[model samples]
Target: MPAQPDYTRRYTVEEYFALEEASDIRHEYYHGEIFPLDGPDGPEAKAGGTKRHNRLVQNCVVALRLALRGKGCDIFSENVRLAINEADHYNYPDVVVTCSPADRQDPRIVRYPSVIVEVLSASTEAHDRGWKFQQYQALPSLQHYVLVSQRRRLIEWYSRSDSGTWILASVRELDEAVTLSALDISLPVADLYENVETGPEEGPVLLRLPD
Candidate 1:
């Protein structure tokens, strides 16, 4: 969701957690700032997932669920919070995968996701590519950060190398497949855009990542 700078009020991590529990809308907490992810303060409500966006997110769940079976890893989508570190960041990703036993025991959030997937929208595109990505990379367990275009047939896959360098790869064509070496599964671009329109108006051509 698009963040608003007008929100000047800051809350301690303790207060942020309490606010999240009491609030109806989901908000992303960064440091002491709270970025409301839904309602009037946010770019759009949590229920505002577009037809194509929601479809793509569900497709990711289907693909990940099948691929992760019997692997002892669990996949969570929407409404699940991912803590970047203990005291610094907490936000909800569209999809998150966690295999940590500690994460398995925690009911409030997952801290060690192996992968995070985001279905991009016009409002939240910049944050997803810029700040959000930077924070996700800080997680030691994160191996892949996947961005799926809701407006077009494109996927930007960012994988971390053994030396901690991030490698960027893009799959632009419908027939191309995005290989997640970490997960050992390749997702066909066509499969992600299946049943969804891909024309200029309906497609996500504007947010194509650089190769």
Candidate 2:
């Protein structure tokens, strides 16, 4: 196997945004290192599941779009890249809802996102719930962060209250419902996993291994 690329070089937030061609794949920059995202398999694959996870995300997006109809907010899927900070860390989330006008400048990437949703996968669950969560909190306009479980029909919502505290609200089973106050909408968990086939009821499983 070939040697992995070195990405320890530090970069300023400005320099990171100056890159002209930074698409085709996803990358995460930390401290000063840039790590290219791996292919969708293994941990990512498990999170994505066979077809259940895909439908869940899709259904959620559709519901959100309908809820925000006539509102200025635009809903985006995984293709849009989001610049988090310096070192040029850019990631593509499963769903992004942005009401900021700056989103029009670059249809392919968004700078300000009001809400970001990551479909929890075995490979990315930890970061989504931890480091990535920290980074997202830095955005002043961010009001909601959602994590959807792939193995089962569940949704965890983190909402930023008026006091700036992030409170956790959850929808445990498929029959339970969830509402995103940030977008002013509610959804049934069943819609999220319309065609999913879950195995035995497993206990709480952490999605990602520690870095």
Q: 1-211, model 2: which lDDT tens digit per residue?
A: 3333345566555444443244343445455444555444234444445365567679879878877888899999876778775344666778999999988998667889998988876656767888889888988889999998876566899999999999999987777877888778777777766676654443343433324
Off by over 4 Å in 1: 1-7, 45-49, 199-211
Cα lDDT tens digits, model 1, 135-188, are 888899999999987666789989999999999999998779888898787888
- Find the 10 residues in a row with the least total lDDT in model 2: 201-210
Top candidate (TM-score) = 1
Give all candidates' CA lDDT scores. Answer: 0.79, 0.71
Give the TM-score of each candidate.
0.86, 0.79
